[model samples]
Target: MTLDLSALPPRRGRLAARPPAVPPGPPGAPGLRRLGLDPERDGLVLLPDGPGPFPLVVMLHGAGGVADGAVRLIAAAAERHGAAILAPESRDPRSWDLVRGGRCGPDVAFLDRALAATFAWLPVRAERIALAGFSDGGSYALSLGLANGDLFAAVLAFSPGFVAPPDYVGSPLVVVTHGSEDAVLPVTSCGRRVAASLDHAGYRLAYHEFAGGHVVPPDLADAALAAFLAD
Candidate 1:
């Protein structure tokens, strides 16, 4: 299933663009920078140091979270793996579109644009692109990643609240982690339930339940990235 942006229907949850060839220019400078795509709610991309065709992880923030915090969650692990990070701000102030309104639209479109810009600016490994998030962002990652599995090779959802894909495409590797004592989105009703649903739907799943609150611990973050980047 190849991605052709022009051939895609006007579906709310579908992503029609593939990783494009890196344009001719000086190598993209490493470290974080604003995407500058949007004036009010812009996104951030953290470029990896050294070399070409680095792995890219599209990180999504939790409810009422911003790009900085989202990137921070995986920054160290991403650096260790030499992976680029693209963290986009939601169009809505509080949370992602799909999580809040039960439909994916503006956020998907904005993400597409952000990804396109990233591809144009840096050399990204097409097969190493992954979608990841925390809490509400985790839920959105599952929804969008499944819908556009051809574009994302893996989905790392930490403490996801639910899974509601507009449509399932390719079968990407899935890793779901949840805190046992999470009060915001409980493990039983949210993360475990999500993992079960995906397993029942025949997705390749790796579920981890930790003893803590609604947070992505450093060890889990490292392990998740290792799994996603594993050959």
Candidate 2:
């Protein structure tokens, strides 16, 4: 069944203009088993954890390109939330095709494959699945979430860099969190501007700017994420 975005809880900032979620095809449907893309070659799996039959989150790395630090953090977060996690390695250092000016190549096609592969490989619920990233990864999440609206439940970007606005979907849930004093990918350059653009675009967004800089504060991340993900 198509989901009613209005049924979801209210978030901070403007209401999201989300496209209706595309319902799952069918049990063991061929469409469900294949997105017919590839990620194993260019994408890397970090740490995997969480309970069975839960929502899956595909974590893309920042400019650092799948650093061990990010892998550990995302693994821990997935374990804590009981959500399955998949972290794909960037082809280049701290890059996700946004900087290199390559379209329909590895970076763009990577997500398409990763989503299909994860959906087929994991035993999680599709409706609850999400895409999340930090920095460049955050930008990718926004891109993928908007482009593949029917595939993701939510899009979370932490200190994201430049992002191209997506055509308005119905009540899309967008979460942008950034520290007020970030030197790397400054809040002003990343989160704030994106939030404003999303606001203007009519997306349901939760824009959070904490006092700190560039890092996801544990307390704030937990609280805000909880509220953001709550049904």
Candidate 3:
């Protein structure tokens, strides 16, 4: 079933939420505008650089992870690749799991608003949007990409383990990489498991295993991470 990206239907009869506050940029220095997709719930700081209609990369952070180092590093990496980024800070510093199978927080609706808000404010090409995430953020990317397949052209997941929502209709190009020796999330059960599910579903997927564990490899290209993104 092909998805229609032109319109984002509200889930459960709810409107898109507003984006969170844009981080202040060097007091008075020209910086990113606080672009709100949904009010205070989901949003990314629009750090506008070169010009308009550029590719947008929406980033999600790790579990028990704040919008701090992990997010900043991922954003920096995307910027180096000449892509604009929107790093959404998760509501809980712990997990994206909504109280053990109940959908109550992280406010999925807010994420929808975040994307819409960026499209409206940033000079980003709507169809060129990419989704990337680390740890918990990666899980969100997996889940959201499946749910809103048409919204993202590609999905990049780093150290991602699990994504709920058993059935995925939209087939966004997927790139999943994990460390063979990962102990923090058990690659055998987590990354490998999810990869298998995607594979069984016949989706366009790229799965990679690194020598290291639980950390983003600095040389992702050598591990074919770049190739996945390029495809």
Query: Per-residue CA lDDT of candidate 1, range 7-113, in tens?
Result: 44438587755666643343566889999988988889998888668889999999999999999999999999888899999999899999888888888888887
Evaluated with lDDT, which candidate comes out highest?
1
How many clashing pairs in candidate 3? 9
**What RMSD does model 3 have?**
6.7
* Clashing pairs in model 3, backbone N/Cα/C closer than 3 A: 17-38, 17-39, 18-38, 18-39, 19-38, 19-42, 37-113, 53-123, 64-93
Error of model 3, residue 230, in angstroms: 3.6
Worst 10 residues of 3 by lDDT: 18-27
Q: Candidate 1 overall Cα lDDT vs. reference?
A: 0.89
Q: List, in order, the clash count of every candidate structure.
A: 0, 15, 9
**What ranking of all candidate models by lDDT puts the best one first?**
1, 3, 2
Q: Which candidate, 1 or 3, would have the higher TM-score against the true structure?
A: 1
Best by TM-score: 1
Report the error of model 3 at residue 122, Å. 0.1
C-alpha RMSD for every candidate: 3.0, 9.0, 6.7
